[model samples]
Target: MERCIDGVCSGIFGSAVFSDTVMQERLPKPIYKKLKKTIKEGLPLDPEVAEVVACVMKDWAVEIGATHFTHWFQPLTGVTAEKHDSFLTPTGDGKAIMEFSGKELIKGEPDASSFPSGGLRATFEARGYTAWDCTSPAFVKDKTLYIPTAFCSYNGEALDLKTPLLRSMEALSKQAIRILRLFGDTTTKRVVTTLGPEQEYFLVDKELFMKRKDLIYTGRTLFGAKPPKGQELEDHYFGILKEKVSRFMHDLDEELWKLGVSAKTKHNEVAPAQHELAPMFATTNIATDHNQLTMEIMKKVADRHGLACLLHEKPFAGVNGSGKHNNWSISTDDGRNLLDPGTTPLDNAQFLIFLVAVIKAVDEYADLLRFSVATAGNDHRLGANEAPPAIMSIFLGDELTSVIEQIETGVVKNNGTSRTLEIGVSTLPVLPKDNTDRNRTSPFAFTGNKFEFRSVGSSQSIATPNFIINTIVAEALSQIADRLENAGDFRAEVNAVVKEIISKHKRIIFNGNNYSEEWVAEAERRGLPNLRTTVDAIPALIAEKNIRVLEKHGVLNRAEIYSRYEICLENYIKTIRIEALTMIEMASRQILPATLSYVRKVADTVASLRAADADYSCVKEELDELVTLTSGLKAAIDKLDQKIKEADASEGDSLSHARAYKDVIIPQMNELRAVADRLETIVDASLWPIPTYGDLLFGV
Candidate 1:
C-alpha cells in the first residue's frame, strides 16, 4: 500500500520499486542500456545479457516474498497461461536451498498436449517451449514471479498469440523505418504499434448471478424473459455508478495499477449493469499482456467485492452488448505520432503516406482483418444494431474526406481559402477547426490521430487483431516504400502512390452511415467483403492471399495459419454446442418443472373454488389455457433436445459441423426458448429456479 505523488496507494509495484529500485539497481548500466535499446529499437535479445537480467529478476522477486516463478504466456485459448515451479532444491542433510537459475528463468516446459493446439502438436507430442520476452519486464503476482514470455511448439511452430504478434510488430517497424528514412527522419529508429483497448463488461450481484444456471454455465444468459425495463430510457449509459459497483471499480483499478496497467477510465456503458475500463496506450505486446491481466484482475477484484464480472460479448439479449474498442496508432521511437496529420495539409505528406497505407491495408486485407475479431461469443454481438457491421469501411470525417477527394480529382480542397481566426473581443483564444468528424458505426474509423477498431469483442485477446493490423499495414507500407525507392522523383512518387492507393482502394472508404441498408447495398456494389459470422469468416483465414502475406512477413507459417483456422472452427462449434446443451438442461430441469408446479397449483385452486362455490368455470378456463401452453412448451423442449443430440451425432469437417450447430441446433434451441420464456411470464416467480432478466440486469 505505497503511494506515489498521485496520493492513491501504489497498490503493490510502486513507481520507486519499478524505476529506481528494480531496474536501476538490478542491472549494470551497460546491460540496462542495451536492454532498453532492444525494447525501444525492436532489436534482438542477447542470450548472455538475458541470463544476467534473469538473476537480478529472481533476487528481486524472492525479496518480495515470491517462492515460485512462472513463465506467463498467452495461448490461443484467448487467455493467459502459466506453469509454476518452486525455487527450492533439496540438500543431502534434509535441508533445502532456494535456487532459480538464469536458464530456469528464461525458459519453461509445459505440456503441449492439453492446450488447444489446433493440430499444431499431437497428443503424443507433448513438448512446448516458453521463451522469456525480454521487452516486457517480469513482475510478481499472487506470490509468483510472472515472467512474460512467448510460447511455441517444440518444432518451432508458433503456438501462442503473442509470438506472431511480436513478429508482426517487428515486420511493421522494419517497413515503417524504411518510410521514415525516405521522409528524412533519421533520428526515429523504430516504429511501434500501440493500443489502448477499452474493455466493457457487466457486473451482477453474485447471489443473483449464481441463481441462473445459464449465466453460470455459458458466461451469458442463454435464455431469459425480457425485462420490463432495459436500457430503453438510456438512463444507465454513463450514469453515476452505484456504491457497490463503484467500490468494485475502485478496487479493480487499484489492483490493475499495481501491475503497471494504466487503468485510466471507468464508467457505465450503454446497458444497465454494464461498464467499461480504458487504459492508456502502450506497445501492442505489453498492452496485450496488460489486457489479459486486466481481465483476470477484474474478475478477482469483483469476487472480493461480492460480484461476478461477465466478459461475454452478448451476455444479455435485446440490449447493447459489450465490446472492446481497440484504439490503435503508430509512433516513432523518437516520440512522433505517425498518424497525426498536422494543421497544414501541404506540410503533412508524411502523415498522409502513413494514413493512406492504413486505408489501403484495410481495403486489401479487410477479410483477414475481419476474421481476427470473429469468435462464437462475438458472433452474437457483431452486426447487431448496436455494433458495427461486418463490412469493413474506413470512416474519415468531412475534412479528411474532402482532402482525399480533392487529391483524387487533382483539385485544391477548400478553394485555397484559409479563413483567419479572429475573436470579436480581440482577447479570446481562437483555433482552427479539425478536418474530420468522428464516425462510430464504421468498423475501422479514422479519428483525429488513430484508427478505432470498433468490432473487437470485449472478451477477445486483442493480440490477434493487432497482429493482423500490423501485418496488413506492413504490406501496404512495403508497397509504398518499393514504389518510392524505384521512382526518379521521390516527392512525385509519394504523391502518385497516395493517389493510386486512394483511387484503387477508394471503394473501401465510406462516409455514409455504416449501419444503413443503403450502405450494405453500396458495399455489395463496390465488391467489398461482408463476412458476417465466424462460419463465414473462418474460411478466409487460410485463403491464399492471406497465407502468402502472413508467410512472407514471417508472422505465421502455413502450418500455423492452418492450425489457427482449425482452432477457430473447433472453438466456434464447441461454444455453440455447450450453449445448446446448457439450454436443454435449463429447459428440462428448471423451466418445465417450474411451469408444471405452477400449473398444478392453479388446478388445485380451481378445484378448491368449485368445492366452495358453483361459479368456478372462469377459474377452470384459465387453468385449461395454462395447461395447453405448458404442454406445447414441454413438447418443444423435447424436440430441441432431440435436435441437439442429432447435431452431436453428425460429423464432418469443422466448418460443416459449425454450420450444423448454427443452423440446425441453434434454431431448435431458440424455439424451445420462445415457449419457455412465455411460460416464465405466466408462471409464478417463486417457483422459478433461475433469476429473470429483470432481476439480473437491474439488481446491481
Candidate 2:
C-alpha cells in the first residue's frame, strides 16, 4: 500500500493551501494589505476588498485543479462539515462560465435542522449562515476550494464550536492587549493565543479491525482479554517504526504539509500499535481547524496503507490510551512571547503576572476546565495509566514552584532537586524549557513557556477545551488589567498583584504525582474539583459562576450555555446507550453463540470418553468449566438487556437519563464484558468469535 508521490518539489509544502504567501503573490498589494488588516485586527471585511480577494482566490484555486467550493465549518458535533457547489454557472446563450463572487465567498446558508444545535435551531427553522472567517486559511482539498467559515443560526446565536471559539479569542486579545499597554508596550497590536496540540492514535490492521463489531460500533474494544505481550516490555515507546508504518507516516506528513498543516514530530508512543504526532504552534482557531483536518487526514492516510487509525481515548484495555496534550501560550503581534520570563525586571514581572493569572484562572474555574474535556470516550482514559487523573491540578516543576513560593512567602527556599540550562539571562537563575522535566502524569502542567492541558482526548475537537481556556484566562487577565490600568506605579502594582494571586490560588499548584491515591486525598483536602467522568462534569457548564464568566466575556450567551449543558448530557446518554447495545449484540449474537458451539463440542467429547471407559476426569473438568461459563454468559446478557429496558422505560430528564446509563447500564455492561473476556481466555482461538487484543494490538 506504499504510495510513491511523484514530482516532489521545493514548493510542495503549501501547494494546496490558499495561504498568506499565495494571497500576497496573487492579490493586488492594496487588497492584500486590507485583508491582512481584517484578519489581524478583527475588522469588518469590506465588500470591495472581498470582491478582489475572491477573484484572486478563485484564480489560484482553479490553477490548482479546484472545480467546486465549500463553506467548510466546524459544528457542535465535534467535527467539520461542508457542502460543495459547482463553480460553473449557466449563461443565456447556452454556455457556462466559472466564477466566484464576493457575496458567495462571504456567506453561505446550510440547513440548520440537520446539525446538532442543542435545540438552538428548531426543525422547521431550517436556516443557518456560514460567514467567512478570514483568520484561517482556505485550501484546495479533494478538488474543492475549502473556505473556513463560522456557522451561526438565523437568530445570530452561535451554532458551531468555531463561533464561540472565535469570540473567546477576541475576548482574550482585548484584555491581554490592555495589559500589554500598561507595560508601556505601545507597539504591540494584538495578543493571540497559540496552540500546539499533540495527537496520539493506534494503528491496527483494517482486516482485523473489521472483525471486531465492538470496535466498529463503539470505537473501543468492549471485551478484550489482556494480551500475552502488551506494552509491558516498554520496548514499543520510541521503537523503530515498522516498514508499513514508516511509509504511512511519510505519506501522512507529506499530505499534511500540502494542506499547510505543520505536522512536526512523529514517534511511537508508550503502547503497542500506538503513535503520536505533534505540530508546530499556530493561532488557536487555526490550530483547532488544523487539528480537525489532521484527524480526518490521518484516517484517510491510514486507509490508504490498509490500516485503521484508532483515535479513541481508550481504544484498547490493559494498556496505555491516547490523549491530546493541549500546549497553549500567548504571543504579541510583534513577536514577543508573553509567557517567556526574560532576564529584565519588567519582563519577569510581566511573565509572572500572566503566569499567576493562568494559575488563578485554572484554580477558580477548575471544575469548568474539567468539564470542557469531558466526553464518553475520555471517561475510560482519564485517571488511567498513561493519562492524567480526573482531578484538576497544575505542575510547575521544582524550579518554578520555588520562584512562586518566594513570591508568596517572601522567604526564599529551594528543593535539592535541580537542573539548570541557560534559556535566557534571567535575574532569577534561568532554566531552559528542557530543564523543566515534563510531568507526564500531571493533568495541567506548565512547560517552559506554555500550559499543556493534558486532559483533552485524542478524538476531541479541542474547541471546547480551548474556548474555556481562553475565556477563563481572559477573565483573569481582565481583572489584573483593571487593577493596574490606573496604578501610579505599574511595576510595583505588578509584584503586589502577582503575590496576591499566588497567596489565594497557589493551592491549585501541585508538583507531585496526580495518579496517586495520596494526591487524590490531598486534592480533596485542598477543595480542588475531582470531576471523575463526563456525567459528573457536565453540570459545571451551567453553573452560575461559569455562565457569568462566559457571558462577561461574550464567549457564549446564557441560552447557548444551557444548550451546551443539555447537549453534553444527551451526548453522554446516547454514547453509553450505544455502547450498551453494542455489547449486548456482540455477546449475544457473536460471543455466546460461538462459545456455545465450542462448549457443545467439549460435551460431545466428554460423553464419547465416558462411553469408551477411558479416563474421562480431564474431559469432564473441561466440560464443567465450559458449561458454567456458557450459563454465566447467557445470564449476563439477560441482565444487561433488562437494565437497558429499565433505562428506556424510565428515561426522564437528560441528567437523569444520563445517570441511568452511567450508573446502571455501564456497570451491567462491564459485568457482561468481564464474563465474556474470561470466556475468551478459555475458548479456542478460532472459536473466540472476534479478534482479541493480541490480534488487534500486534497483528499489524
Candidate 3:
C-alpha cells in the first residue's frame, strides 16, 4: 500500500496526511474554497455544488482503492455503526460500471427500529435517514469510502448523537455570531466549538480476553478478585510503553491516519494496562466523527496485534477506570482562539466576555452537564479516587479565579506589580498561566484555554456532551448579548453581567478536591445536586428547564429529548441486567462447579488422612471449613438469582425500572461477586474455571 511518510509527522499520527495541502489536493479548488467558507461562515451548502463535490470525492476515493461505501454514524448505543455497499453497477449484459451518484453519496436509509431510539421508533417503524455531513470529509479505509453522516428517524426526530450535536453546533454559532457582532467582530461571520477528546483504555491479550466470558460478553470482568500487584505501586502512569504495546500503538496510529483521524498523542495512563490517545483539535462535528472512528480503529487495529481493547469505564474493580477527557473551546474563522486571553487585559474584553459565558453556562447547568456523562459503566468509575466526582464543579486556575473575583468585588488587588510599555522598546511582561488551579478531581476543569470535561466515559461518543456544552454556552452568550446590545455602555454592561454571573453562581466553582467525602457533603450543603447514579442523572435529561433550553435553540424538540431520556435509562437498566445475568451464569456454571471440585479434593484428603491415622483432627477441620464456604457461595448465588428474577418481574417506565436495577439488582450482584471472589483465592489455580484478575491485568 502507498503511504505518505512525512518526516514532520513521523512521531505524530495525525501529522502525515490531513494537512491543509493534502485537503486542497483531495477537493476541487472551487468546491474546497466554498466548503471552507461554509465551515467558517456557517453558510448553507448548495445542492448543485454538493453534486460536483460528490463527483470529486468519488474519484478520489476510487483512486484510493475504495470499492465500497458506508455512512458512519454514532448511535445512542455509544458506538459506531455502518452498512457497506459495493460501488459497482451492471451497465449492460455482462459489463459492470463502477459508479456512485450524488444522491447516493448524500443520503442513506438504515433500519431505525433495530437501533435503540428510546421510545422514538416503534417496531413497525423501521425507516431512518443518514444525511452526509460534508464538513467532515469522506475518508477511505480498507477498500471502502466512509462518509460521516448524522442519523435521524423518518419522522425527522434525532435518533443519534451526531444530529443533535450538529444542531447544537449551529445553535452555538448563531448565538456566538450575535455576541461577536456586539463586539464589532463583523469579519468573523461564524464561531465554532472545537473539541479534542483524549481517550483512555486498556489493552489485554486477546487469548486471555477470550478465556473470560465476562470480558468477552460484557466488555468487563464481572467477577475478578483484586490483583496483588495493582496500581498501588503508581509506576504505570506515564511509564515507558512496553515493546508489544508500542508496536500495537504504532499499527493503530497508522490505521487511524489512513482514515484521516488525527490521533496526535499516545501515552501510558494511570492504571495498569491502561493507555491514552490524544488527538488534535477540530470543529466539533468533525471531531465527533474522528473520535468515533478513532475508537473503532483502536479496537480493530489492536486485534491485529492479538490484543483486546477494553473501552469500559470500569472494566475491573479496585483499579483506576478509563475516561475520555473532552477538551473543548470556541474559535473564530480568522485563526483566533476566543478562549485565549490577549496581551492587554483592557483590549481583550471581547475574549473575557466569551470566557465568562462558558463559566456561567457550566455553573447554571451543572447538573445537566453531569447528566450528559451519566452511564452505568461510568457510575462505577466516577467519584472513585482516580476519577473525578459526580458533582459538577469548575476549576479555573488561581489567576483567572482571582481575576473574576476581583471583577466581582470591584477590587483590583494587583496594585503594585505594574509594568509599563516603552515607546521605543518591547516591555510587554509575560503573563502567568494563572486561571485556576488544575483540579483533577473536578468534573469540569479549565486547563489553560479550554475546558476539560473529565466526566465523559471512555467508551462514550463525546458528541452528546459537546452538544450539551455548546447549547448551554450558546444560551448564556445569547443572554449576555441581549444585555450588552441594549445597554448604554458596553464595557460597563459586560463587566456588570460577568460580575453578576460570578456572584450568583460562584458556588459552582470549586478549586478543592471533588473526590473527597467532605466535598460531597459541602456540595450538598451548598445546594448542588449530587446525581450519584445513572438513574438519578437520566431524569435531568428531560427536565423542564433542559427541555426548554434544547427546544428554544432548535437543538432538539420535546419528542427527541424525551426519547433520549427513555433510551438512556433503558440502556442503563439493560446493561446492568445483562451484567447481573452474566454473573448468575458464571456463578452457576463455572464458579460453583469449581468450588465444589475443590471441596471434593479437600474432603478426599480428609478421608485419606483419617484412613491413615484415625485421629486427623486438622484434616477434618479443613474439610468442614471448605464445605461451609462452598455452601455459603452456593447460597449467595441463589440469592442473586432470586433478586435478578424479581427485578425482571417488576415493570414500569424505564426510569423506575432503572432505579430498581440499581437499588435492588446491583446489590445482589455485588453480594454474589464478593462470595465468588473469596472462593477464588481459596480454590486451587488448576481447579479455577476462569482467568483471575492477576492473569487478566498482568498477562500482556
Whose lDDT is greatest here?
Answer: 2
Q: Candidate 1 versus the native: TM-score?
A: 0.94
Model 1 residue 487 distance off true place after TM-score fit, in angstroms: 0.9
Q: How does each model score on lDDT?
A: 0.84, 0.88, 0.81
Clashing pairs in model 3? 396-436, 397-435, 397-436, 397-437, 398-435, 398-436, 398-437, 400-435
Residue 666 in model 3: lDDT: 89
Instruction: Candidate 2: give the clashing pairs.
Output: none
Off-target runs (Cα >4 Å) in candidate 3 are 1-23, 26-29, 122-125, 414-431, 434-437
Question: Best candidate per TM-score, number?
Answer: 2
C-alpha positional error of residue 381 in candidate 2 after TM-score superposition, expressed in Å: 1.2
Q: Against the true structure, candidate 2 has what lDDT? A: 0.88
Please provide, for model 1 over 550-572, each residue's C-alpha lDDT reduced to its tens digit, 9 standing for 90 to 100: 99999999999999999999889
User: How close is each model in CA RMSD to the real structure?
Assistant: 4.1, 3.6, 3.5
Per-residue alpha-carbon lDDT of model 3 for 501-610, expressed as tens digits? 87988898888878889999999998988888888888887889989999999999999988888888888878898888888889999999988888888888888877
Q: Which stretches of candidate 2 lie over 4 Å from their true place?
A: 1-10, 413-426
lDDT by residue for model 2 over 596-685, one digit each (tens)?
A: 899988888888988999898998898898899889999999999999899889948888889988999989988898898888998888
Evaluated against the true structure, the overall lDDT of model 3 is 0.81
